[model samples]
Target: MATKKLRRSAMLGRVVAATATLGLVAGLAACGSDSTSSNPTTDSPTASDISGELNILVSSADASDKAFGEVVDAFNAKYPNAKATLNSVPNDTYPTTKSAQLTAGKVDIFVVKTFREMPDYAVDSTSEDVQLAQSGGLLDLTDEAFMKNYTPSVLDSQAIGGRQFAVPTGNSYVTGLYYNKKIFADNGIEAPTTWTELQSAVSTLEGAGVTAFGIGGKDTWPAGLVMNGVVGGLYPTAADKQALTDSLWDQSASLDSGVPLEVLQKTQWVFDHAQKNFSGAGYDDMPAAFANGDFAILPDGTWNQPTIDTAVAGAFEYGYIPFPASDNAADNKYLNGKIELQLGVSAATKNKDAALAFLDLFSSKDVYTKFVATSGFSSAQPDIEQSEFLNSITDITSQFEPVWESIWIANANAGDAAAYPFNYPALKPLGSDDAAAAAAAANSAWTAAF
Candidate 1:
């Protein structure tokens, strides 16, 4: 596990550095959706011609990323005057492409990799990027009835100062433990409530010739994702260690400043416990192994649920559980999630009302139901019923809200340089056994400096 972690950590740096040194980095990485129907409205005196084409951009490596086409299709059904076109972009280049489009005013409606595209996404005020979007006159939904459809945290992601720049399309991706129900039951093992219990469960599975945890070291994000669970499990209160999650536009306290090194150090234990072959696995590989009952537990994201369910095809009984926090059952569950896959209206959109109308359609109960059911993701709107995946994910999110809120506050103060490492990249080396000493040294350095 330690070796795997080291390899993964090195791989991530190499990838980033390689992209940098080679000047191979380009903008706009993502696939666009297919053409959908354009619903043209009756000619209006007040608004721009309703029959003109509307451009909607979806980002991803795969041109057919699901929501883009479906959205266009739905929109075109009613607005015959509007036709939708998909623009596929690579993930790595998305930031550049999006920026260029914004500058050239070539985009009417498009998606941006908010987290990656924004340099100081979690912090920094007066960032030209955010300001540009705001200046473009974002479709303000503050007073719109659809505002009721989203959760506050979801909305908060797009909100700068008092105004919102985008509409939330989905909630954050949650990372936790997904276990095989039959494996636990057959072994007479209960779902672990503490790190110790979790270890015991893993040990039981390993003794029976199954991998204890199905981990993916490839697609580096999952490495961070799983580690988040481990870190959260160790420091249930770590969420609050950060004072702000909206630091990008504010001058706030350091999110990592107050956290004890001991909390961050617990990741060492998680590193020691991970499966031995983690280095060999990729994101897609884990669910395939889980379905085969090769592992008893997997630390991945809620987004993986759809794939997991499909892989198992109902042959196996599986359950999603919050990662345990140390050995204390009384300690609150800690959850790690991301605010990716959100939606924002084009600031330049001439059809503010129509754009908002489309956003409202996204938040509609029917859309929420369909999206969650199909995507295996959760929703932000509190009123929406919890799908099976949401039921599990939300339980953990609610359990750890206090921790996240604190982090939000701290990040708000510390900005990017401070907040990002506390949440990501910082814990990468801790999972490596060989790097245990290095991890300790890094932890001490961060703690002392923080």
Candidate 2:
């Protein structure tokens, strides 16, 4: 899992234009309502019994992963009428393995990670295994009640062409920056409010023989995050942010808008100036280096807070700030994130009520509180009181709420066929040159393609 924060200011407002360009496809829109009829009459005799077993599958590194066995035990304790067996697979093979099980009719529930590079946009985009699963009459979870608890963005992801399919699990996976407070204090650097100051700060750190920015070009997603968030950071106005987000979703909204170009330039500049081997560094490597003080600054998200907090053991001092961009004080902005992981009920499960009940269990105050406290992640449900860690994330997210609403929320390009975003990595290269004409041409090609 990625453990890095985006620049706090730009974190909320910033729209990841690059991710739009990447062309990574995942499942789409949720629609239709749950049927009131109990099991179609044609499908054998309906069982009156509500008690049955459901198989739940998820990607690796989940907080409840190692302890999921215990969570299942706890669940069984509370609901003796229902039982769920847990199955976890390493991220790399999850798509195929899970698909096979679903096709073979061996699994009942599925949990997918949205930010994973090759996201499963739909059950069957490129993989035959996924196709097999879809061919087996898997249920689409449009009408499940658990969906009522989700925020709009989470709901949007599940609705493909107005049809609901998946339920978003974790809250939006945020991206931002983390800086060593000691480095800023020792160098007499106030957190840079504008791009110019940001550049100067990095220069000072470099001159001091300290790596100023931890650039992880090797991990394409984080690198792309910096590039996209830059667009939001530099253009603080809601209208401008919205324009960018709109452009990403609706390519015709604008052409070669200056903000995206600026963002791309900033990313390239950081990559060019940062550690020599940054291009080869992975996401974990960059944060590990930052935690060790190998680098004074890192562009990441709240997800990494747990690891950093653990690594420093409270000895390392750090602070959250927006990603730097060339903007006046009035233009300085914060980008808010939506959710990182998504959860949904199985469409094909014979035990629809049981599945919904399980999801409801996951969303309960008790489970939510425990999950957020232990995971250092925020809750998507409005009812839950955010944990201390999530509270900090909320505070930061609140600062850029306007940007998020304008750019990310309103201007989402997720379903825009023309945007052609396959994944963040693929999109980053398209914007790499940072040339105005190049961007324009890219946008034009995108518009033409879809």
Q: Candidate 2's residue-wise lDDT over 326-353, tens digit each?
A: 5574454454455544554444456666
Point out where model 2 deviates above 4 Å.
Answer: 2-50, 62-64, 97-105, 112-165, 172-174, 203-210, 219-221, 234-257, 280-282, 326-338, 374-376, 382-388, 398-450
Which residue window of length 10 is worst by lDDT in model 2?
Answer: 23-32
- Give the lDDT of residue 249 in candidate 1: 27
Model 2, total clashes:
73
- Model 1: weakest 10-residue lDDT segment is 28-37
Global lDDT of model 1: 0.53
lDDT of 1 by residue, 347-433 (tens): 555454455545655667876666655544556666566666667556566532322322332222222323333433444442333
Clashes of each: 52, 73
